[model samples]
Target chain A: MNEKLHPFHIMILIYMNQTGVVIMSLPHLLAENFGYNGWLGVILISLVVNLNIFIISIVYRLGKGKSIFQIMESSLPRVITFPIYMILIGVWSMTGCMVIKNYVYIYQIMSYNTTHAMLLKLLIDIIAYLLIIKGIYTISKAATSFFWITSWMLLLQLFFIKDFEWARLTPFLFKGDTHFLTGGFIVFTAFLGYELCFMLFPYADNPKKFIKSVYKGNLITTLTYLIFCLICFGFYSFEQIRNMMYPLLDLLSYIRLPFIERIENLLFGFFLFTTIVSVVLYSWSAQETFARIVPKANKKVLAFIILTFGYIVAWFPDTLSEVGQWLQYLGYAELGVAFGLPLLLILILVIHKGAKPS
Target chain B: MRTMPKAAALLLVIVIIAGCGDQRILEKQGFIQSTGYDLNGTKNDEKDNRLMITVDIPKSDPEQRMQRETLTAIAHSSKEAKILFAGQTELSLVSGQLRSTLFGVSLAKTGIWKHIDTLVRDPSISQRVKIVVVNGRAHDLLVRDYPQHPRAGQYIDRMLEKESALMSFPLVTIYDFSRDYFDDGIEPIAPIIRENKKNISFDGIALFKKDRYITKIESKQSLIFSMMKQNFKKGEISMKLGDGSKKQEYLLFSSVISNRNVKVKRSTKGNFNIQINIVVKGSVLEYSGSHELSKDYDRKKIEKRMAEYIENEAAALMATMQKHNVDSLGIGRNVRNSLSYEEWNKLDWNKEYPDADIRISARIVIKDFGKFK
Candidate 1:
């Protein structure tokens, strides 16, 4: 392939992936565990997640000439790498569909209904399949275009600034040791997309700047999470934050302009774009990994098969609450893959380095 | 040709699905703009969960004057009441545009949290819906027609909106009320309104002890309480000036800009004392005092007197709220944040609130002796 992704493109891709449907539930999670000290908790977790990204960065640095899948195939025995790839593909495919299920749930409640949930899920799957088959270069180009326009959604929080009560965060760090740590753990779930770092490593044209690009992406997302956490915390009392299911959408409902009515409904439609990109990234990663098992097949065909698998996973949940439980399971599985794989990959590199001729 | 035909069939199916939305046209749907709830029976009827609900909907015709329809029913919940209303009304009753919900004094004092759950659960209702407490049966106020004001929903909405903006009272949306209700150390308060022979108007604020309304602050000093909680812009604070011997006895300050700073201090004995300082900057719209307007010392004396009066009034307002054991000012919230979680949970702020040593002071500055001086 002549076309290669720039480090900047990789950064934008990872950035988009980190901040999808998960941001809606974040403030409530933090507030449930930590009281007014939720802001501090968010900052602490962002740093820890950054540390996890550093582990992925080490994987990028060690595997200089190859993709992470290629590196794994070469470095480890088939016994280990095979199960790891299978587990990753399973988790990624389920998680991708889970994002769509969540988006459909939001759509069902917010908009006057038209299509049935199954039909909506199928539509999402088809759109995602079309995009995923276009390959990574095209996906990155889409992400780049999307990163500029959708970022203005952050500016919507500015309308709530006059109503923000800073006292909601006053006398910070008043919570106990256990609550603070637990809050950090909850926030870590929100920063799950950085695991894509390992997958996107070989795509960067200048491989040396890979770490810098990843860090840049992580920082911008961290800053995004931090700004939103502050806005939500300040905009609501601590109790209000606890009761809110989707804080960003609730915040959007407050705005009314001369030109617009029900701004949140419009924005929810806009966030549909972000949700599509997120699912596309995860399912595409799954397709690439699953392609190894059937090397003779076309990747475009493989992507369709993976997209069908996502549709089946999405169908398993009968209701919104059931879907939430499924997402919780996906989140735990993701944590396992996100934290465990990078650390294991880095360890193999360390051992490989130690056993060298020098 | 076969592939193209299959694609077109699929596209048609999807298009049909897209257009088959839950139909709720403006003319066909009854949009409940405002609702009022009153306790159904006598005050002693404890077991009766029944409520009398009154809903007001705006007329669709542009040419019609005072064109609003009201439906009243005895139902168990706001949702049930809506179902009952739909049975009686021509159009389907929906709460999509629910702008105001008022609780009668009897219902409010009994508790409104359970009744408000329907509003919170309904995905269509906006959190911006104004929640108010009416002194008499809210149904009485909801049914009355004002030919001059036309739509009571719009009138009441504009009344609450304008009063809150002008600093007559705080803007207590259901979101705000729930926030304070759910918080550990704070309490919720809402605009208390009552109707007289002349018309319906804002009376004061109804303070709550948890979900139940415990007491109220009169409309006169509501602005002062509002300022203590937050800053107020474009207010008018008028005071009685001279003794009964004087014919002219009032001073009015308009275009008011005021702010408050509340500080909580703890002594070595583990006691919390609150110090509140309110600063008011406004122009003198009118003065009936004997002091010369042009003189500096007289102006200083007037400012000092205004400060003293405001400080006294502040003390009285705090006393009233404290007497009810309501921490509507969020003094307890401040004290809670100052301690660790363990320490905060251990302290019962409600027990401590009524007797807390709180000092309130005011510093008033009159920028203009007359309008645009």
Candidate 2:
């Protein structure tokens, strides 16, 4: 399946993974943690995520044409590997659930107002099921199309700068070095999509193009996030920016044209496409891990089960704070897999080479 | 497979559920055009904090001569009053079309930050909606049917928008207010509207020391204030030009081009002196004076005289504002931009601004001084 993805298509998949429901309320998280100095936070987070991507690409070189599953099978025992596979599956499925839940909640707030949560979840699950059954090839093609779907989002930012106060980004010198480090870790979960590169790298048409394509994808995500942060900073007060749960939507409401009354509703409706791609990709990855573990099991059945499990678990969090708590724990686990695993594997490989008298 | 019917049934169920939710029929909902908030009392009682909300909605039939409905209520907050308004209207009222909000003098002085927070939090309201301070009770204006635009909200909104672009007042939106209110070195300023000649008109500018209204400047002073702060698309400055003897005559300077720059520097005593430089380029539209302006030297003399007068007036306005410790001109913001974050945090702007020296100097070019001798 390495031949299925072109190098450029990898960028689209990574971009889709990087941006979604998370970017909607990003200003809230960044401003709460960093104040007027979030530009520094953007720099620091990108630096760390870039380091993670580099290490993962190194792991790919070590794979030596072996898929991640094959590499793990050759290096570790089944007992150790089996639990790791289960954790990955759980992570992918749980994160997909969070994305679905958050996007649905935001949609209700912005559009429907009082939609039945179960119905929204059912609709998303069915769509994701249909797409996931077609597998990665279709998902990648959908992601490529979704790239065009969402490319118009940044145009809204251009019209919005007329209200921007350049002085809002004032006192431009960086002072809070420690706050940047803390803020970097605080928003570490937002940079989770690039971590998918490690698993998806072996599936690229050329693993040699994986590093550059992933970095380019990561760069696009970073710049997009930076623009959003700076625009929110310029357009909103520190306290206002800090308090707004959805600054971008609030900003969109500011754009008053005679023809359109509720632009955010329509925009958020289009954003559902990005969410579909996200949930399907996550469940599809979980599908891959499921097949590797069972080997002889029916994969389509497993994929549907994974998506259904996400839809069911998404309803358990009755409160937003519960979702926050879940995501906080999930963020830590995600960081462990993104950074801790690759670094540990590199160390193990280094020692193994040494012991083998290479 | 036996799953095709199950899938079709599921899809049908989802579609039915989606269409069964709330239907926001446009005609059945009252679209609030403007809102007015005033404090009920003056003390620490809950009644003191009780907010009186006045909302204006226009008639759907455009041909109706008297075309507006005014809803007034007293409640704990704007949100509460909105909920209480359901009893008064046959249609459900929605606030998505809100054009402007006016706060009574007492409410503004008491502090309107919390009220502003409610506006910003509501996703339905537009951030471009103007916020103003009324000279008297806010509800008074909402009830008056002006001759030009019977709806008080549309009248006030159009007046504010036009004046903001073509006259003396600054364009103050909810977005601008929130930005200035939260910044450490600046404070928000909005236009003041008052009952004049049985109709509402822009009276001046309401200045704030933080969120509380401190004082206001009349339209004449507000002209220079607006000029010193932002660029104008077009406006006029009219004033009496001399001592009450023969030189005292009216002059209207129109087609005005002006800009301002503030420089913060250390004086000889190591204290800060902010130098404000203003340049005005305008042609005299009306001159009732007897002075000859055809000569170049006379034109130079008139230009110099106008410059001196503006400089003196602007300086006096700044001195009065400094007496009240108001930084509505953003001098503190300009100075703060020049320092490190630590230094900015350490400096007390409130203390420094009152005692700080401000100098305003102007140069009026008088592009084409009027029609004739």
Candidate 3:
């Protein structure tokens, strides 16, 4: 593989994964746990995750230019390495499918009455197939273009400032310590994408710049999610947000554009594109992880097969509420794979030194 | 080179597929301007909880010039009724355009959290929708013909906005209602809309203990309640001063603005004392007196009168709300946030709130009068 793609490309991929699905869903999940202080939890989680990313990047740089997979393979047996790689790939693919499914559910609820569940699954599979066929660099390029375009929509939230109630965020600290831990865990899930750095570590043209790119990407996503959470908390009270199935969509509905009556429709349209980019990048990364493990397998064909399987998994969730609950469980499992495994691998690598590649 | 045609063909297919999923214009589907929930007396027995929902659909044709056409359906649940109503209507019943929701006296008294939960859960309905308590039946409020506004929903929405601005009622949106419904301490209140001749006026605000409208605060007192609780940019306060001839004058003042600061302090004895500071600015729009007052009136006398009037109004509003056991002012919320839930529970707010020492201090500064001499 040619080391032509910069660490900036890795940053774009991570940014796409974090922003698209998490921003839309985090407020509701946080509200369920922390009530009104959900936005505060988002801020806390972002700060914590960025610190984790910084620490992880330092650890990666310490390992010279070798990827986490290489470090893990050298540190552990091939049996453990193969299973860990497969599990990591599975987590990414599941998360990708969940993101696509969530966007489709939002679209069906907001825009069209007759939007078939199968349509979104098919769309995800098609995009994944095309991106995989073109190779990982093409997918990274598409993500980079999307990152630039969607950065503007972050500004559109300013229009809703008038409706924000600062009083809703009152009594900042919880009455009890229990709420903080529960809320912290939920918000931590929103920052799960930063761990993508582990997989994309080898693709960075400049491995030394990996820390810089990861910090920049994580910072952007953190700030964006914080703003989104604040806007949601400001608009809907703690209880209203908890009751709402799709709190972000509800928040957008309150925003009446000067000319356009429904702002959620426009948001839903833009979100569809971002959601596609998010799922495609995740699926492509998952396919790449699989390709690395089995050198004999064709990457494109494997990508298609995995994406089709993901579509089936996504389609199986019966209702919108069920899909959301399933995603929470998936998020917990992905969090373990994304952060837990890497931390463990980094710890093991520190204990045992790796031999130089011939 | 061989894959170029296949890529082009694939791009063409993507474009075609994308074109198939374009957005649906909301106006094309019949938009529901407002929804009214009422108890269906005819449908079920006392044990059965049946609700009839009246949806106001705007007539599309300008020439038709109809105020509004309503479709009513009774079902076991709101979602069921909405679905049933959709089947009855000619156009798709779009809930996004919904501006207000009215609950009938009976329906409101029965509690509306179940109905509100349905409204909030539905993705189509917006959180900003104004929720109000109708004086009479919700169906009558929706179905009755009005001369002023073309649509009943528009009429009710405009009336609520006007009253809320005038400091007659605290602005109660669907979001606010839902917040109060779930909060342990704070109770919610919705403006009560009633018909007078051909037009509608906000006569009072319906106070909700949870989702039920437990009590009502009439027009003048509702103003005082609003002023004490909410920030107002514009309003009017008229005072009848003195007796005939010696009656110096009755002042009709407009352009009234007020900012109230409420502080809750726990006394050394463990009881709470509330201190209210009302900073007011207004113009004497009309003064029927012998003295030809300039742009600036006797500052001392105006200030004294303003303080007296505000104090009297505030006291009366508080007394009225207490008499009815309606804590719509969120005194309970202040207490809960100030103290623990266990502590708040031990001291019955309904009993203690009225007895709590409420000291009000008013500061008035006259900004302007419309070119008066």
Which prediction has the highest DockQ against the true structure?
2
Candidate 1 structure quality by residue, lDDT tens digits, B95-169 = 778889999999898799987776766667777888999999899998887666747788889888887778877
Looking at model 2, the pairs that clash are: none
- C-alpha-based local distance difference test score of model 1: 0.80
TM-score of chain A of 2: 0.93
lDDT to native, each model: 0.80, 0.80, 0.74
Stretches off by above 4 angstroms in model 3 are: A1-12, A35-38, A47-51, A72-80, A176-185, A296-298, A343-358, B1-28, B42-49, B62-67, B74-76, B83-89, B161-171, B242-245, B295-297, B340-348
Residue range A110-167, candidate 1, lDDT tens digits: 7755557877777777778768988888998998888887989888888888878777
Error of 2 at B193 (Å): 1.3
Q: Candidate 3 deviates by what RMSD?
A: 3.6
Tens-digit per-residue lDDT, A26-145, candidate 2: 887787777665655776788888999889877777655446676667668999989999999998888888778777777776556777766777788888887888868778888999
Model 1 / residue B149 / CA error / Å: 1.0
Calculate candidate 3's fnat: 0.31
Best by lDDT: 1
Interface RMSD in Å per candidate, to 1 decimal?
A: 2.6, 2.0, 3.3
In candidate 2, position A168 carries an lDDT of: 69
Could you tell which candidate, 2 or 3, scores higher by lDDT? 2
> Which candidate has the highest TM-score of all?
1
What are the runs in model 2 whose C-alpha is more than 4 Å off?
A172-182, A347-358, B1-13, B42-49, B61-66, B243-246, B267-270, B288-296, B367-373
**What would the TM-score be for candidate 1 when compared with the true structure?**
0.94
